[model samples]
Target chain A: DVKVTQSSRYLVKRTGEKVFLECVQDMDHENMFWYRQDPGLGLRLIYFSYDVKMKEKGDIPEGYSVSREKKERFSLILESASTNQTSMYLCASSGRGLLDTEAFFGQGTRLTVV
Target chain B: TQLLEQSPQFLSIQEGENLTVYCNSSSVFSSLQWYRQEPGEGPVLLVTVVTGGEVKKLKRLTFQFGDARKDSSLHITAAQPGDTGLYLCAGHSSGTYKYIFGTGTRLKVLA
Candidate 1:
C-alpha cells in the first residue's frame, strides 16, 4: 500500500510564531498537495507541488507557502501563525497521470494557534 | 471558476436506512472521485467515475456519473455506524491537474 506520512498529529503554537508542517510519501508520486479542512468549507487547497522546487497556488494560498526540496517530501510553511490559521491540515500525494487518479493522504495534522 | 457543490450538507438517519448524496457542477469535468473522511483522519478515496453515465458499486455504496460529466451521486444502502462520516466529491477539468473538491456532506447513522 502507498503511504503518506505527516510529521505531527497535533500541534499548538502561539500567534506570530513560525510553523512548519512536513509530509513525506513513499510511492515516488510526482504530485504533492497541502489542504486545510474546516467545518463547513470542506477541504481547501493551500498549495501543490508537481515537481522539486515547483509550486502552484491553490484556491486559498494567501497565508501559506510550500517547499518541495526533494521529490518525496513537501513542506508547508506558515510565515506567522495566527488564530485563524488553526485548522486540520492534510497532505496528499498522487502519481502523475490523468486528473482522476486517486490521491493518497496522510493521517492529518491538527494545528491550534493561540 | 470550477466548483463542485454537494447537497444535503448534513444527514442523520437510523440504521438500515438508505440515503443518497449528490454532487453537482455547472462546468464539465473529465472525471470525478468520491472520498470519505473520519473525524480525525484525512479523506480516503471511495470510488472514481470517469465515463459519462457510468455506475460503479463498492459493496453497499453505489456511485454514478452524469452523462454531461458535470454531476455525480453516491447512494448508500443499509446505513451503519461504520458508514458515518463526511463524504466529499472532487473533480478536475478535462486537461487540468488539480482536483477541485466539493463543500462536503456530513452523515450520522444511529443504531
Candidate 2:
C-alpha cells in the first residue's frame, strides 16, 4: 500500500524555536504538499513541491517553508514557532497526474507552540 | 479568502438518517476530491470526481460533481455511527496547481 509517513504525531515547541516536520512517502510520487488544518478553516495549503529541489508557496505560506532534497522525503519548516502556528500539520503525496490520481496523506502532526 | 466553501459546517443526525453536504466554488476545477478524517487523524481520500455532472457511489455514500465542475456534493444513505467524521472537499487551483480544501463539514452520527 502507498504510505505517507510523518516523522511525528505530536510536537511541542517553544516560541521562537525553529521547528522541523519531516515526511516520507513510499510511493515516490512527484508531488508533495504540506497543509495546516484548524477548526472551521479546514486544510490550508502552506507549501508544495513538484520535484526534488523545487518548492512553491501556497495560499498561506507566510510563516512556513519547505524542503524537498530527495524523491521520497519532504520537510516543513517553521522559521520561528509562534503560538498562532499551533495547528495540525499534514503531509500528502500524489503521483504525477493531477486529474486522475489521489493524494495520500500522512497521519498528521499536532503541534503546540507555547 | 477561501476558494472553496462548504455549507453546513456541522451536522448531527441519528443512525439510519440521510444527509447531504455541499461544496461550492466559483472557480472551475479540473477535478475534485472528497476526504474523511477521523479524530486525531489526517484526511483519507474517499472519492475523486473528474468529469462534470458525474456521480459515483461507494456502497452507502454517493458523490456528485456539478455540471460546471465548480461544485460537488456528498450524500449518505442511512448513516451509521461508524460514518462520523470530518468531511472535506479539495480542488486544484487553476494557476497554482495546488489543492485547496474547503472549510469542511463535521458530521456526527448518533446511535
Candidate 3:
C-alpha cells in the first residue's frame, strides 16, 4: 500500500511565529505538492517539486514556501504565521509522467495561527 | 491561471436520493479526476476520466467528462449517509502535472 504521512494532524501557533508542516511519501514519486484547503476554496496549490531541490510556485504561493531536501520528503514553511494563514494544509505526491497524474495525498495538517 | 468551478456549492438530501455535481471550466483539460473528502481527512481520488465524452461508473457513482474536456459531472444513485462528503474535481491540462481542484461541492445525505 502507498502512503504519504504528515508530521502533524493539528498545530496552533501564534502570529509572527515560524511554522513547519512536514510530509513524507514512501511511494517515492517524483512530483510532490503542497496545498492549502479552505471552505469553498477547495485545494489551492502553494508549491510543487518535481525533483529533489527543484520547486515551482503554484497559484497561491505568496505566503508559503516549500523545501524538498530528499525525494520522499516535502516540507511547507510559513516564515511568519498570521491569522489569515490558518488553514488545512495537505501534501500530495504523483508519478513523473503527464498521464501518471494520480496523486496520493496525506491525511492533512490543520494549522491555526492565532 | 486555470480555474475549475463546481455548481450547487452545498446540497442536502435524504438517503436514497440521486444527485449530480457539475464541474466546469473555461480551460480545456487533457484529463479530469473526481475526489471525495471526509471531514478531517485528505481528499481521495475516486476516478479519473481521460477521453472526451467518457463515462465511468464506480458502484452507484457515475462520472462523465465533457467532449470538450472543459467540464465533468458526478452522479450518485441512491446516495447513502456514507456518501456525505466534499466532492472535488481536478483538471490536468495538456501535458502538465498542474492539475487543480474545483471550488468543491459539499454534500450531505441524511439517513
Candidate 4:
C-alpha cells in the first residue's frame, strides 16, 4: 500500500515563530501537495510540487511556502506563524499524469498558533 | 476560479436510512471524485466519475455524474454507522492537474 507520513500529529507554536511541517511519501510519486482544512471552508490548497525543486502556489499560499528537495519528501514552511494560521494541515501525493488520478494522503498535522 | 458547491452541510439519520449528497458546479470538469474522511485521518477516495452521465456503485454507495459534467451526486442506501464521516466532492478541470474541492457534507449515522 502507498504510505504518506507526516512529521508531527500535533504542534503548538507562538506567534512570529517559524514552523516547519514535513511530509514523506513511500511511493515514488512525482506530485506532492499541501492543504489546510478548516471546519466550513473545506480543504484549501496552499502549495504543490509537480517535481523535485519545482513548486507552484495554490489558492492560499500567502503565509506558506514549500520545499521539495527529494522526490519522496516535501516540506511546508510557515515563515511567521500567526494565530489565524492555526489549522489542520494535510499532505498528499499522486502519480505524474494529466488524467484524473487518486491522491494518497497522510494523517493530518493539527497546528495551533498562540 | 473553478468552484464546487455541496449541499446539506450536515446530516444526521438513524441506521438503515437513505440519504443523498449533492455536488454542483457551473464549470465543466474532466473528472469528479468523492471522498470520505474520518477524524484524525486523511480523506480516502471512494469513487471517481469521468464520463458524463456515468454511474458507479460500490456496494451500498452509488455515485453519479451529470450529463454536462458540471455536477455529481452520491447516494447511500441503508446507511450504517460505518458510513458516518465527512464526504467531499472534488472536480478536476480539463488540461489541469489541480483539483478544486467542495465544501464537505458531514454525515452522522446513529444506531
Write candidate 1's Cα lDDT for A46-92 as tens digits.
99998999999998899789999999999999999999999999999
Over A6-101, each residue of candidate 2 has an lDDT whose tens digit, in order, gives 999999999999999999999879899999988867787899998999999887899888899999999999999999999999999987753435
Best-to-worst order by lDDT is 4, 1, 3, 2
State the lDDT of candidate 3 residue by residue for A1-114, as single tens digits: 679999999999999999999999998799999999987567888999999999999988987889999999999999989999999999999887656857888999999999
Pairs that collide, model 4: none
DockQ of 4: 0.67
Candidate 4: where are CA atoms >4 Å away?
A: A98-100
Q: After superposition, how far is residue A36 of candidate 2 from its true place, in Å?
A: 0.6
Q: How close is candidate 3 to the true structure, as a TM-score?
A: 0.96
Q: After best superposition, candidate 3 residue A113: deviation in angstroms?
A: 1.3
Global lDDT of each candidate: 0.92, 0.91, 0.91, 0.93
Ranking by DockQ: 1, 3, 4, 2
Off by over 4 Å in 3: none
Off by over 4 Å in 1: none
- RMSD each, Å: 1.2, 1.7, 1.2, 1.3
Model 1, span B1-111: residue lDDT tens: 888999999999999999999999998888889999999998998988999999999999999999999999999999999999999999866555588899999999999
Better of 1 and 3 by TM-score: 1
Candidate 4 lDDT over B18-37, as tens digits, reads 99999999999888989999
Model 1 CA lDDT for position A113: 100
